[model samples]
Target: MKKNKKNFETKFWAGFEAGNPFEASDALFDFAHLDYYKRNLTQAVIYSFKEEICSNNTPSEIFIFYKAIGSFLKIYYSLHKKSSKWKVKEPVRTEDVFHLTSLTKEEYDNPFTVFQKAFAETAFKDFEFFLAEIINLSLSPCKEDWNIDLMSPYIHLIKMLDAGELMRERGLEKIKK
Candidate 1:
């Protein structure tokens, strides 16, 4: 089992290096096969890799994140379904974290549906602001240790845009320097 897991990782990473997005599915499968108890902080690492390092497209990544997080959230969601070992500690539901499921099979049935409901259930203000900041503006408010800091430039860029002081008109290269 251990050798199989290692080989799975190797093949997945090799496919990643080869720029084949389809391998991401096999990697996702290998990822899902892990014992939940052993996942620990590695869950975030896997999630962030799927969100950032593995992808070069920002909106595409966000689409994947949004489209997949319901499945992810449901891992914590089933805990509160009245048949689990865990309990919901917070009455207020937030997207980033919650106490519910734990990556069970039920959560994997249809991830996109979960995300659609999640997006619909979320307050528009929260959804829109996050979309503007993270999507339109390209920020990483959803920080996980494996990813880079995207807030500083996002902040500076939004400020400039809001104030109508952007330098893109001056030149695209000017934003970095």
Candidate 2:
């Protein structure tokens, strides 16, 4: 089979980051890849729990959302093989991104599926709605809904990203305290 050669490293996303939702520039979007995807997701989760949804979230609740975001990033990585890069660059319908509804027990796992379902529903509804759904799920994920385990190594990656960002912005004292 002849490999198709084309520019794929420049895929774009809305460049969501922690605290602020979108970047302030005329270009608008940011490139999409594993790291950016994870960061945007982490930011989305952070946005969800920051001040509006609830300020009293437990550490476990925050972990669940991070785990969920990590799981989705894995799914995206599995489907897309393009190398990760940052540039500036979406035509597919939203439903196409949410096509995990038919996976079986062997294919798809539990809490991750729950998160994915919530994400699919909220993804197109603007940041406010998206964060609301994420916060709700983070607060009370229906663990009974799925039978598979709910942990991924990506959770650690996300934690590192967030922690690094925190350390850079607020220093280690604030992160530890």
Best by TM-score: 1
Q: Give Cα-based local distance difference scores for all models.
A: 0.29, 0.33
In the range 1-177, model 1's lDDT, one tens digit per residue, is 333211212232223321222233333334343223123223333444343432334445444433232222222122112122222122132342222232223323222233334434443334334333344223343544424344433232222121111111111111121
Clashing pairs in 2: none
- Candidate 2's TM-score: 0.21
TM-score against truth, every candidate:
0.22, 0.21
How far in Å is the alpha carbon of 117 misplaced in model 2? 24
Among all windows of 10 consecutive residues in model 2, the one with the lowest summed lDDT is: 20-29
Name the regions of candidate 2 deviating beyond 4 angstroms.
1-80, 84-136, 141-146, 153-177
